[model samples]
Target: MDQTTAIIDLDLPGPRISRHVYGHFAEHLGRCIYGGFFVGEDSDVPNERGIRTDVVEALRALSIPNLRWPGGCFADDYHWRDGIGPRDQRPRMVNSHWGDVVEDNSFGTHEFMDLCELLGTDAYISGNVGSGSVAEMSEWIEYLTRADDSPMADLRRRNGRDEPWKVPFFGIGNEAWGCGGNLRVEQFASLARQYSTYVRNHAGNEVYRIAAGASDADLHWTEVLMQSFDALDRAEEADAPAGPFQAVSLHYYTMTGPWADKGSATEFSEDEWYLALERAGYMDQLLTRHGQVMDRYDPHRRVGLVVDEWGTWWNVEPGTNPGFLYQQNTLRDALVASVHLDAFHRHAERVVMANIAQTVNVLQAMLLTDPESGALVRTPSYHVFEMNTGHHDADSLDVHLQGVPTRTGEKSELPLVSASASTRGGTALVSLTNLDAQAGRTVVLDLRGRDVVGHSARVLSAPGLATHNTPEAPDAVAPVTLDAVRPHDRGLEVTLPAHSYVTVSLTLA
Candidate 1:
C-alpha cells in the first residue's frame, strides 16, 4: 500500500466541549461492589467507610469526572432506605436479575456519595422507578440534596454525614423500556413526568434531570420523548423546568460477529478483531442518527445526549464466575475505546456525558481488582482514558484523513487510521490509533493552518492483536515514548506503528 497522507483543516466551528462525557459507571453487580470497590472494612486491605482506600486513590488519579451509581438493573430493585444508618440494621435482598446474589445494602447512599467525594467526581444517580413510587424518587432527591433541619437532613446528619453533597446529575430511570420496566414509550414518558415532578432541588442547587432514553438507535423512542416534551410544554406553560429533559440517554455495546457468537476477550482471529473494530466504528452512525431525531425537536440543541452506558461486552474470562462479567482488555479494547472517544469528540456539540458500562469487574472495566490481595491492575481501557484526558474541556479541531480501509469484511470496513485533535492551553494534542495489524502508517498532519512548534508522541502497542495484560503481567500494555518529530513549516509527519495507539502533543508557537 502506498504511504497515504492527508491535509486536514485545523479550524473548526464547534464551541469548546465539556469533559463530563468521559465519566464512568459503577454498578452493584458481581464483584463490582463486594470485591471490587468494597472489600470489607475489616479485611486486610486498607479501607475507609467500607470502601477500599487504594481503589479510591487510584480512581482519583484518573481524574474521573463523574460516576453513575447503583445500577443498570440493580437500580430498579434497590431500596434507598435499606442502605442507610446502621450496617447491621440494613436489609438484605436478592439481586434477582444479576446472578441472584443477595444484596446486603451495606454499600448504599452514604457509601456511594463518599466514594464520589474521594474520587472528586460528580455523582449521576439513577433513581429506582420500576418497582418504586414517585414519592420514593422524590424522597431520594430530598435525602441526598435537601439541606437545613428537614427530616431527611436530620437522618443524614444522624448517619454521620453532616452536610448534603452536591448531586448535580440525576436519571429518571435506567433502560426504562427494558429491565427498568418494559414500558412503552408513552408509558415511560408519563412515568418520567410523574417521577421527575417531585425531585425538588433545594435553593441554589441546579440539578440536571435526564429522562430514560432510546435503546441503541431506536428512533421511535426518541420521537415519543420529543413529542411528550412538546406536549408537556403546552400543558404546563411557564411552570415547568427550563426544559422537560436536560438530556436524553442512549446505550450501545460493541460485540464481534453475532451477539451469541461474540469473539473471546483474550483469543480472537484477525478477522474477528477487525470485525470488532468495525462494530466499534458504528458509534459514528449511532450518534448521527440520534442527533438527527433530537435536532427536530431540540433544534437549538438545548438538551444534551448522555450515553450513560457504553463499552465492549465480550465473553467472560475463563474460570472466572460468568456472573462476575470479567474480561481481558487487549489492544482491541483500547482501539475500540479510542474510536469511540474520537466519535464522541466529533459530536461534542450534542454529546455531553458518557459512562463506560462500568468501572471495575464488569463489562469494559478500567480497573480490575484482586479479591485475594486487594491489588488493582489498570486495563488498556484505563490507559486510553488517561492518555486522552487532555482532550477534556478542550476545543476540538477539524481533522480529515485520506487513508485506505483498515479491514474489509462482509458487513463493514474501518479506516486504516482514526484521529481526533484538540487545542487546549496553547497546545495541540492529536490522538490517533491504527486499527490495521499488518503494517504501520505514516500520517502527515497538516498544521500550516494552525500554529504549532515541536511535537512529542506516546505510543501503546503490543507484540500482536492477542497480546494482553494478565494479573501476573500487568504492565504488558503500557505506553512508551516514541522518537521526537520536528514540526515542519507546513506540517508534521509521524509514523504510527501497526495495531498501535499513539497520542501526540504539540507545543503551539
Candidate 2:
C-alpha cells in the first residue's frame, strides 16, 4: 500500500466545545468512598472531614471540570435526610445491591459540596426521585442552594455550612430506565416533570436540569424525552409556564466477551484486547445514533447531550468483592479513552458533557485508594485524562488521516490511529493515539492553515501490553516527556510507539 497523505484544513471555524462533558462520577460503591476519597480524620493519611488530602490534590492536578455524586443504583435508594447534621447523628443504611454492605451516610450533601470546592469543580447532584418524593427533591435543592432563611437553609446552617453551595448542575434521576425506577420513557417523562418542578434555582444561578435518558442506544427513550420537551415547550407557549430541560443523558460501557467470562485485568490474549478496543471504539457510533434521534425534534439544537456515565467494565481484581467493581488499567484502556474523547470532539456540536464512570476504586478509575495504608495511587486512565486536559473547552479543529485498521478474530478494521486537535490560549495542541499493539506508526500532522513554530511532546507507553499499576508499584504506568521535537516548515512529524498515547502542544506563530 502506498503512503497516503491526507490534508486537514482548519480554516473553517468550529463551535467552542464545553469542557464540562469531560466530567467524572463518584459513587458510594466499595472503597470509592469509604477507602477511596475518604480515609477518616483519625487515619494516618492527612484528611479534612474524613476526605484524604492526597486524593484531593491529585484530582485537582487533573483539572477535573465536574463530578457526579452518589449512586448508580444507589442513587435511587439514597435519601438526603440520612446524611446531614452531626456525623454521629447520621443514620446508617444497608447498601443492598452493592456488596450488601452498610452505608453510614458519612459522606453526604455537605461533604460532596466541600469536595467540589476543594477540587474547584462544579457539583452535579443527581436528585433522588425513585424512592423520594418531589417535596424531598425540592427540599434538597433548597437546602443546598437557597440563600433565604427557609427551613431547609436553616437546617443546613445547623449542620455546619451556613452559606449556600453553588450547585450549577442537577440530574433528575440516574438510569431511570434501569436501577433508578425501571420506569419506561412515558412513565419517566411524567416523573421527570414532577421532580424538576420542585428543583428551584436559588441565588439566581442557572441550574442545568438533565433528565434521565437511555441506558445505551435506546432510541425510544431519546425520542420520548425529546417529544416530552417539545410538548412541554408548546404548552409553555400556550401559558403553561414550563422550564426547559437543559440536557438529555446517555450511558454506555465498553465490555467485550461474555459478562461472565470478561477475561482478566492484567492478562489477556491479543485478540481479546483488540476486541475490547473495538468495543470502546463504538462511542463514535453511539454518539452518532443518539445525535440523529435528537436532531429530529431538536433541529435547532437547544438541548445538550450529556454522556454522564462511560468507561471500560472488566472483571474485578481477584479475591476482591465483586460489587467493588475494581479492575486494572493498561495501555489498552488509555487508548480506549483517547478514541472516546476524539469521538466526543467530532460531535462537540451536540455532545456537550461526559463523565467517566467512577473516579477511583471502580471501573476504569483515574485514582486508586488503599484504606488500610491510606495511600493513593494513579491509574493509566488518570494519565490519559491529564494529557488530554488541553482539549477541554478548546475549539475543535478538523483533522483527516488514512490508515489501515487493527483487526482481531472475525472483527477487523478498527481505526489504528485516532487524533483530535484544538487551539487554546494561542497554542495548538494535538493528541494522537496509536492503538495498534504490535506496530508503531509515524504520524505526519499537517498544519497548513494554522501556524506552527516550536513544539514539545509527551508520551505514555508501557514496556509490554500487560503492564499496569499495582498498589506497591503505583508509578509503573506514567507519562514521559520527549525533550527533542523540532517543527518542520510544513508541519510536525512524530514517531508514535506501539500501543502508545502521545500529546503534542505547538506554539502557533
Indicate the TM-score of model 1: 0.95
Per-residue lDDT over 1-509 for candidate 2, one digit per residue giving the tens place of the 0 to 100 score: 12223345555547666788679999999788888887777977789877889889999988999999886788889998999988899999999878999899988998899889989999999988788888998889899988879999999998898889988889999999888988888999888877887787888866889898997879899988888775433423544323556788999988775778676777888877778888787888889999998887766677789999998888998989998898878877887888889889889999889999889889989988776676678988899999988888988887778654556544557777788877776777788887778887777776777666578899999988878887798878899996535454557667788899899987876
lDDT of 2 at 120: 94
Worst 10 residues of 1 by lDDT: 231-240
Q: Give Cα distance to truth, residue 270, candidate 2, Å.
A: 0.5
Relative to the unseen true structure, what is the C-alpha lDDT of residue 112 in candidate 1, on a scale of 0 to 100?
91
Give per-residue lDDT, candidate 2, residue 273.
72
For candidate 2, what's the RMSD?
A: 2.6
Root mean square deviation (Cα) for candidate 1: 2.4
- Model 2 has an lDDT value of 0.82
**Candidate 2 residue 276 C-alpha distance from true site, Å:** 0.8
Query: lDDT of each structure?
Result: 0.83, 0.82
